[model samples]
Target: MPAEKKAYPLRISATVLEAMQRWADDELRSVNAQIEFVLRQALHNNGRLKPAKVKPLTDDDTR
Candidate 1:
């Protein structure tokens, strides 16, 4: 089964939001989906997003 969707609250300047909306439309993705995709790409590029080899870390390692 697919995972449940999670909601996130984001704050952005009007100009940036408008640009994002336009880009999302051009890519045929919902604004939320576009933002999530962009964020995931960035995380993966920076090695922040990776498969878990062991158990999850606590708050200390996260920082």
Candidate 2:
């Protein structure tokens, strides 16, 4: 199951928001997703979160 999510209000400057929007667009992700992606990366880099293990794809799974 996916982890439960909690909502939090964020306040950001327009300049930074615009930059994030552009980056999110380039990566084909919503601004919220982009933000979460960046936070997750930062946490992993700081050793605060462990890396997730992904299962390898198999022919049977592809069907």
Query: For model 2, what is the error of residue 26's alpha carbon versus the real structure, in angstroms, after optimal superposition?
Result: 0.3
Error of 1 at 55 (Å): 23
lDDT of 2 by residue, 20-49 (tens): 999999999999999999999999999999
* TM-score per candidate: 0.71, 0.84
Give the TM-score comparing model 2 with the true structure, all chains together: 0.84
Number of the top-ranking candidate, with lDDT as the measure = 2
Stretch of 10 with least lDDT, candidate 1? 48-57
Q: Candidate 1 on 1-63: residue-level lDDT in tens?
A: 444788878889999889989999999999888998898889989999984357669999998
Model 1's number of clashes is 0
Q: Which runs in model 1 stand beyond 4 Å of their true positions?
A: 51-63
